[model samples]
Target chain A: MAVYTHLGAEDLASLIATYDVGELVSAKGIAEGVSNSNWLIETTGADGAGARFILTMYERRIELDDLPFFLGLLDHLSAHGAPVPRTIHCRDGDAYQLIDGKAVALIEFLPGVSVDQPTPAQARAVGAALAEMHRAAHDFPMERANTLDIGESLRVLQHCGGNALATVDPALPEMIDHAARLSAAWPQGLPQAVCHTDLFPDNVLMRGSSVTGMIDFYFACTDAMAYDIAVTHAAWSFDKSGGRFDRAIGRALLAGYESVRPLDPVERQSLPVLAQGACLRFVASRAEDWLETPVDALVTRKDPMDYVRRLHFYAEAGDNPFHPAAD
Target chain B: MAVYTHLGAEDLASLIATYDVGELVSAKGIAEGVSNSNWLIETTGADGAGARFILTMYERRIELDDLPFFLGLLDHLSAHGAPVPRTIHCRDGDAYQLIDGKAVALIEFLPGVSVDQPTPAQARAVGAALAEMHRAAHDFPMERANTLDIGESLRVLQHCGGNALATVDPALPEMIDHAARLSAAWPQGLPQAVCHTDLFPDNVLMRGSSVTGMIDFYFACTDAMAYDIAVTHAAWSFDKSGGRFDRAIGRALLAGYESVRPLDPVERQSLPVLAQGACLRFVASRAEDWLETPVDALVTRKDPMDYVRRLHFYAEAGDNPFHPAAD
Candidate 1:
């Protein structure tokens, strides 16, 4: 709902006509995904057989140039025996196409429902999967991507005026001001790699306690590997109250990742700050988005303080403390 | 620039003509904003010679329907003596206009350089200003805004697929799963009020360690005031290495906020979890945005994890421990 794809059943039908894979039985929007338009496509062949695949209309909201790198990485991972969706070729023998001005592709559906919650064992499996993917992706052809230089996030905060500032209890502005200054002095120059920038639990698919597949490759790029690890730690370790970090969970994830592609000393050393950076980026962006969202789009409210506190924790810890729980 | 407003200069000219107040001496783009095209217009002649105003091309990236609320709020705050940009009427005596499919408006500008950082005393001033604004806006009429609903954020997390999940360490899926389950039993039904959805440090302007004004009203809407306090705390307080919490700063901020507007027991009770929820929202969104940004924009990188850890901290504490730093 964040984007309007200008796609409809008719457009889908017309597009599918050229792909002689099979007679289309039905296609409907799947109730998953926040960034792209995804439809579960069911098809019956002339031979009276059937198969299911996910028809995804790549979000134009994302930069189109990055598509090849993302898909290529997925292909590379899949070729290397990573658990990922296999790109189904289109009628033109291409794995991807531009349909209705969006990067459209068909991916063979992986079996298994998304687990709402996972046990520690399942968490360990996820660690293993990620470690394996990072290890396999080391030879990804594209170079690493850098942080966006444009201060778009800073600008967003600037857009909300006095009223927004008023809501914050008294001393916050100074603390923020201090952090902003200190942020200028934050460490730089870290080792880079093919980073899965948006890894979180929901992105992984499971069947009973085993991670069956990993999906969504859009944010994949070359960046600091430690950043990727920090992202994972942040996403995996926090509890529901968003209050405490679960040491066991953090250990499992890191252990899983390290088992495949061992972290260098520098990567390990910078993990905490990398985590802090992740927190700042989100807090800044969410605050801006919260300010920018239209008054009535059925858009949900976002709390800006959660990440603020999280950043504080990472600042205090100063390093990754948990060993891999999976091992 | 994310958006291009075709007629920025022309729109400013139109406003000048309508207001019949002054002659424009200079207009230049202010590069500090992310969502809208802004220009500083120096004016001379009628109402006040040697005066300045800001011409803004409303960003179309925002939900168009919400412009009125934002602009109207600005006007209201200005009327109540809050240091804000006063809207200048159009030739037809309207506060806003459409030019080249963009919302265009002009407002009286405050003249001062934006201080990048402010001292703790200034932070207190910011807190006091916020209190004044909240007090002024307590009865100002506006519809409901973002409520920081946890359900929607959880839904988005669920859609993040393996590509996104893999980027995170495996342990996160379990942690998220646990959080989702625990969230069902979390407290609800708290008092709500108008909140500034964003209040980061950069949004406030200071002159010689004195907070002169608060700017940006795009995210201002009706929500819990504590959420605003949490947002401020998140923005202001930080630990050393810029990842941990500074208790003194937190105290200063909270003291400033509570001085003007006393928080009832209920609001105080909700602060910790509200802070956690805020962290989750930022982490989830940053993860999603990381996935969506174009790989080539050089504008993309992993979000910081500080906020995630802070969430854990708050969860562990299970209460707000903020107190004013003793002068």
Candidate 2:
């Protein structure tokens, strides 16, 4: 609620007229997303006579610098025949426009409902789609985004040690400190690739039992490809209790990913530790955020132990046993 | 940063003369906390001769109704000679004041530095202090707070099922549903007592290896004592990788607590599920908050899986193994 983008009816109608494929029919705000202002635009045109698209006003509250990359990435993927949304170019031949101080983009709206919990088949399809996207964009040029590096992650975990140990549990600091040291000692020198930094289940769309498309590339950036795989594994492998990783699902996902683009031995070797690093990063942030929560916002209590346990899981496992398909 | 509370040097001197304290030699803001503005007031007066106190402007963001209960609880504990800051009675012997649209209070500041991590002895001391505080407040009268009972918790988990199952692991929703069902079936007849809702490590202060004081009682309210223990256990027992619970630390904490105040049989029986419930509550809140993070905060990504594993741990454990020392 800190920032918002609003589009008036007249502006939306005028904007819709510029698109060659559709006649301006109706536009209404979609209430789904919390981030950007989305309008479901209905168009009647000679091509299909009737088609639906989403007109989005980029929320200034989120990083605006990454907008071009996300939109361009989708455009590139669509051009390569990937089952992704096609960015609707404006009359000026631009994929996006600056309107009313917000970045505005129109994309062909794919028909599907977001599934809360996807079955193994759905997860597998997502894994496959992600692999394909990674392969297709392997050479795509983009600057690195997130500021965090391995050293920064290590520093966060190290900082938590003092706070963790000083409480009712005296042993947590040493354990976190040890994990930080171990993760720091992990071997480096892997090739970096474009990664969908935020690949939570909600970001992927499912049609029937299969993933039809992937969305939300706002966090996508140039990073270690294995780290993305690690993120995918972490996202997909945990059971509801979140206590243990599901080996079957892990295998299914890895198999699906390898079917499209296989991971090298070094990438495979670094995964478990990368996952641990991911866990540590989240824990440290949550811990710090917990301390900073306004006394009035007492409803928000950061659960530091979640990442703590996840870090432990990666440490104990040493390496992920599931292998990507041997292309 | 939004509100300023300090008076000018001349104004502060004039204000000091009206109070019982002889003279305020020095006063400065404590910049550590993100909430309430705090000033370390050094005063020389006939009553205490030379004493230092912390004057705090209670943040309006916190529930104003609950402020009296927290102030009373602190006053009651200090009066009982507990190792807590003593609230200083104002000119009219009141413990609080309305200053510049905010609640303000002054308390004799306990001498100690906030330690990052405490040794085993420090943890034990905190455990003992918490137990003693609980025992002392057993008969203190207060209205019940946080009406979202056990049933509400079950409802949230059930509602989150679709979202939980649709991600990487389909089993997570099943586990949450199972825990919810099991928790629903369990008997609930535990006695209620005053509980410190937020007892994380940083909230406790230490002088060397000894815990000198506990602060931040904004969430203190009447709740099940076993729930408080569960909160403590969850806070204290996690190992470094954050994947496993440190049974040794758990045992030590329980032993330390029981040395001062013992848990009833029924209370002991309910601890595990309560701990699971605590885990569930945090996970649910975090998951909801994850959807709300400003797209721009690019500062951190909140991982929901961390809590899933914790809930699984308590569910697998089945029952709390904690026992108090023989008095």
Candidate 3:
């Protein structure tokens, strides 16, 4: 949720020197990334004008061995000319450098802001961006399993215990029941592609409804392409608490995704269940974090009930939420 | 310490239009500032090239009424050709616009890094910059008393109680004793200037060894200029934990300030007491925060012992620390 590593100017200067980027001018810690430290690095370019970059230090919830896959995906996506920032390799041609036993990488800075209350057009653009990324990542050389899958969600919920979940939110215990139902009804073997499983609005960069970049590829993995759409829809269609559903934005997202690669009938059919599954993913994770904190701690932990609301919305709305409304 | 406010792109774009600086290009939440939300804002210039600015949303630990003094000091010091950034006036000629009950201001982004590990030359530059600010702020219209002075420190310590302090560290109550002594012998009315009382290394931005910006004037007030130097010394001259003191940095910093505005005899003699007072200020604040947290909580609060160590160092070294060391 915040930058865990405290990098100094001297440290940053030495790190930037390895990238063939000119002298380091400044590095500001960006208040972003869930389990990593990110800096908006500025350096003198070959033309003496300052160049901007994002230097990410993998701090937590990341394996050092998985660096090649994450960095390689960005490389593959960028090489395919998707709107993804390429991972800048060091002079030694390495994707990342191991500093103090943690892996860090330099990424090209793309211009744009991440819209929280995205317009319908912006939603469509993000949908298109995801579809394009799916196409670009179709032939990526490396592979990693989606570790936080249906089984894992159930395991986490069980680990949290029903009483603990109830303590956090009265409705949270029912998420376990929903997870079981989702597990039984989960779709099997549709179309597969590399999925940006966490394509919330924050992971997207936009300028005037155009997506300049799709970032934070740490959670990316080989998964059902339709599941990615469901995840993005579940993410962008609702308010943070999942109390309000924007059907227009939801339709725009699906239309934008379909605009690039038209969804198969099978993919469309699996969406309702996939969306429910997506909701449960957040439910399990947020519940674990919520239950870990004391009952009265002032620490601002995310409410798992947010996802519980989304799960119920999906259950009640079914396929009707995806239909486009007359503007 | 972190961005507490979540400003959406729409919120930022509308905010930027008020400043008349440029069209919003991008805004990143900078992981800086102790109790305010800061965004590293980028906007397109009239020349069509992009420019950078820091947009701050005053969240907590700041009074809305005191904004004029804070922003006005920047405008005053900037006009006086000090290396401080000027506040960008709104189209309506306001220094800061009230947004949803919180005051927001745009400031010219200065180029430099907030060095955690500062060089001797860098320390010297920061000292010179402080002296320049003191001279420039000699006739500023607004005046705010040093609220977080020795008196406040003692008050906060008394509020925290001896048991709470002892629980944090065995020697924390010793800080109370030292603080009392400093309060009893505290110098009265020698010299007055608008002092940046919290001139830590992070507050002073640097390019190589040169100081480009002296920022984060939230704690600026009319206080002893010598006390400002002592605050900067207690801040910049020691490691974060205050376990180790750098003699070269201390000597260089004092010499640099003396170069700009030569220290009076009384001021020079009072450095040790002022430095100890500075450490106690930090100790009081950190102790309060530390005592408020649960003993087993994983929250990474700053240790008050860090400043406690510095307080002890000042007590032992006396005036010896400020004198130039033999090469």
Q: For model 2, what is the alpha-carbon lDDT of residue A281? A: 59
lDDT of 1 at A213: 77
Off by over 4 Å in 3: A296-298, A323-327, B296-298, B324-327
TM-score of each: 0.47, 0.45, 0.96
- Sorted by TM-score (best first), the order is 3, 1, 2
A1-327, model 2: which lDDT tens digit per residue? Answer: 111444544466578777776565544344334467676666675396667677778875456677778888888776776667878888788888878677888987764434445566766777798888787777676665655545665676566557654462454566566555756676577777778866766566555556656776766778887787777777677753347767767777787788888888888888877887766656666666665555454233556666666667777777744554321
Considering TM-score, which of the candidate structures 1 and 3 is the better prediction for this target?
3
lDDT of 3 by residue, B1-327 (tens): 578878899989898888767788888999888789899999996467778999999998999988999999999999998999999998899999888999999998998888877778888888889899999999997889989999889989988888878888888877777778889999988799889899887887788888889899999999999999899999988888899999988888988898899998899889999999998999999999888877666457899999999988999988899766533
Q: lDDT for every model?
A: 0.64, 0.65, 0.88
Winner on TM-score between 2 and 3 is: 3
Chain B TM-score, one value per candidate, order as shown: 0.86, 0.79, 0.96
For A76-177, candidate 1 gives per-residue lDDT tens digits of 888888898778766677767886567888876665434434556766777788777777887878864644311333444445443573364242233345
lDDT of 2 at B17: 60
* Model 1 TM-score (2 dp): 0.47
Question: Backbone collision count in every prediction?
Answer: 71, 21, 3
